[model samples]
Target: MRKSTASPAKRINFKPSVAKVIRERVDGKCSVPRCKNAIRGPAAKGTGSINLGVASHIYSAALGGPRGQGGMDNAFIASAENGLWCCQIHGSAIDKNAGEGYPPEQLFAWKALAEARASKLITDTPSPLGWVDAIQLLRFPHATTLPRLELSRCTLVAGVTASGQTSLLDLAGAVTQSAYAQRFIQREPSTSRVPFVEGRLTYATVDALDRSVDVQVLGDDIHRILEGKPCLLPPGDIQVIYTTLNDLQARPHEDDVAFLLRLLGVDRSALKAIANAIDLRLAPGPLRFRDGVEEDDHGVSHPRRTPSGERYVEAFCEIRTDELPAEVTLNGLSTSQQRGVILALLIAKAQQISQERLTLLIVEDLIVNFDSSKFMQLLAVLGEMPFQVLVAVPPARHNELLEECAGVATLKPNPDLSSWRLRWLGAPIQDSSPSVRRSGVQGSRAPIAKLL
Candidate 1:
């Protein structure tokens, strides 16, 4: 073997003119979608400005740099075409871990989207609503004072059994009046009546409209107040979809196929397209539909009729597994596999929906059923989604979850277990403790009311 000493490729640095051009293309905003952070702002001192923008290289400038080592001309690598403008936070994020996860193709797509948005904004077009930043819980059961849980693009709520994990999720659903939460509340008589619970929601709307409105829930009613004045609605409509273990469990009347199709708001053709788009494989065989016969209580075949007096034929998904000698329905899969399928369906639905209104997905104890590898695969799929996500997990995976999520809210019961205490790990925010306190009784308001 001959030892040939070859020097490493020299780094290519972008010129000042090229950097300026890249930043101006996005109008000094971060290139990451929905993260329109102003990279340059007025300084606190007199007559000055601060620049927090970074002209990052889409491709590596040096042989060993992140996303580097691609064979390209030095001149092209240092040109403005290879540069992207991002805020300090995102610029650092895209280069972390030698760019193991962030690929050049995704970066190119983000660059194109940012440029398009900037161009549209120049024509006086309004931007879309941003994600929910934080939610404050003033009053709730089994908690003396609950802190404001600051939400990021992705958040994890990790706690032990009976440590208020479900309570937090329920409060979120109840406050938003989500369909799933309403179903749970109606089923459980104890949760139907809430004496008095007041909280504030902080978010941003179009044209940089930052808002924080207080929402009061009394029994089965909800009230919204904005800037000390009663309002009919929040700044914008927030579509929330929350899923619990009950949603994944088998139902007597409806099977998983029908339940998932309804929740996704799509037909069988669209379902197949979604499954293929995400490259999700549930079992060894493709999903197929077949005619099923209905059975009466006595295990006898019964001829069911539709509203039009026609024969009703049941349809179910036939899945094949290694353990089973014959094919079985989706219900026959393990609980963990079923949950994975549900998550995939939700992700597909999120992708199909429009981005005009902010959408949020909340799942309780999603980590309880799957192994670490499967959980990580689902988490990676969620990372590419367009909306916000909040997942609750058990305490056993808190440490591991913390590393993957933008932030982690750890819930713990107090000494006497009368209330719960929350602690946030990761990210910096204005307040990390509970502030507002409520104690009183109020008459129940109407289900829906107009602003006076």
Candidate 2:
């Protein structure tokens, strides 16, 4: 068992004031009254200084929306018009529910909401899809590929192909198409015809690479698209949604796509209730083993014995999409682990986050020195959260932490036990009368509702 740390996250209600992130994106408090428009530097922030502004979820907190987010469309970046320019204190307060919705008149409302916002109940209004901030971008580090719009049943959705082609408006440009063609037609333009595209949002294909990026515009046709499905999918099923944290973080290969899917538990749907978190590989170095052995790369014999036997954990730092450096330091862990953690949290609460209702998180193989018991306790406390938590083993060994989990699943070979698969639940074991006994335990009766 690795030495577990006593650190635990204080129970916090994920605030709805948290806005989405976009490239140089920021929600603008209208400098003009009733004009309902504004602008700012960017949605993403730099480490060196401060970008002072208020972040408002396009979907209000009162509307059962996720904290630190706006709406289904604006999940990745906050809009310039979606927020106001309040100082940090007010931003924090409103972020912490110390403020009320839709720009209130006084500070008193903020204080009350801070203290009572979690308890204060308000019904959400059916907002017309007019706000520019109400539009959803595909995902962070926006894709330059043409987007695919789905006009399904109720909501119109837009995103690029996994390979970055075919946009929503491109498919929906003709609203007067034949019904069969509208249902499942392949769009092919005739040699001499160019149909006029009408949409509240517009996108252009800039490149074929995963890093290919383009500017997006919001329009009324796009709004109508937003109000209706983009003919993206057939009727009657949940959708599994995914977005790249950073297209350049890794190769734009199917392996990367697979990882993203597994992380979200919806590798193939429009909606998922879980997501995989990332492990930061800020720099590259040798892989280490807990048993004083370096992986693949062998170490030289000491002329004199060193005091510390060996180091096992890889060194890392947390980062977001834009923060990744061109060169990395490690092999196994290779992206923005911090943002992966954040996205995982959001995934566990997708309905809330996507619809803007709640926030949740999970992290796998987080290498830490905290003791197993202490760590398990913290995980338990976190599991009680309104959202969800599913942390993986922090990439260590000895199975000390694994055995201490609230739930454990091991897949050892039935005959020889030569190979096995083990999973950890991150919480302390709950004492149940029907304790699991291994295959070798003499006279133990088999028990199963289904061993899954």
- Please provide TM-scores, in order, for all candidate models, with all chains considered together: 0.51, 0.19
**How far out, in Å, is residue 225 in model 1?**
5.9
Give me the overall lDDT of model 2: 0.28
Candidate 1: residue 410 lDDT (0-100) = 37
Residues forming the 10-long window of minimal summed lDDT in candidate 1: 438-447
Q: What C-alpha lDDT, on a 0 to 100 scale, does residue 219 get in candidate 1?
A: 49
Q: How do the residues 160-235 of candidate 2 rate in per-residue lDDT, one tens digit apiece?
A: 1122111222222222111211322224532422212222222111110011111222221111232234443221
Displacement of residue 252 (Cα, Å) in model 1 is 3.9
- Report the lDDT of model 1 for residue 307: 47
Q: How much is the lDDT of residue 239 in candidate 1?
A: 53
Model 2: how far residue 187 lies from native, Å? 48
Report the Cα lDDT for candidate 1. 0.57
RMSD of each: 18.3, 23.5
Cα lDDT tens digits, model 1, 1-452, are 12213235687888999999999998888987668677787999989999999999888778688987456567667777778899999999999999888788778767776665566456423225455667666665445446567666666554322333444455565444533333222122235434355566665443233356666555455666665576775435565566655555544455444566665657878876765544364222334444555698899986665544555434333454566645545555566765666676666666555275766677655456577667656556655567777765444444444332233343333232112122342221113232211111101111111110
Each candidate's lDDT (Cα)? 0.57, 0.28
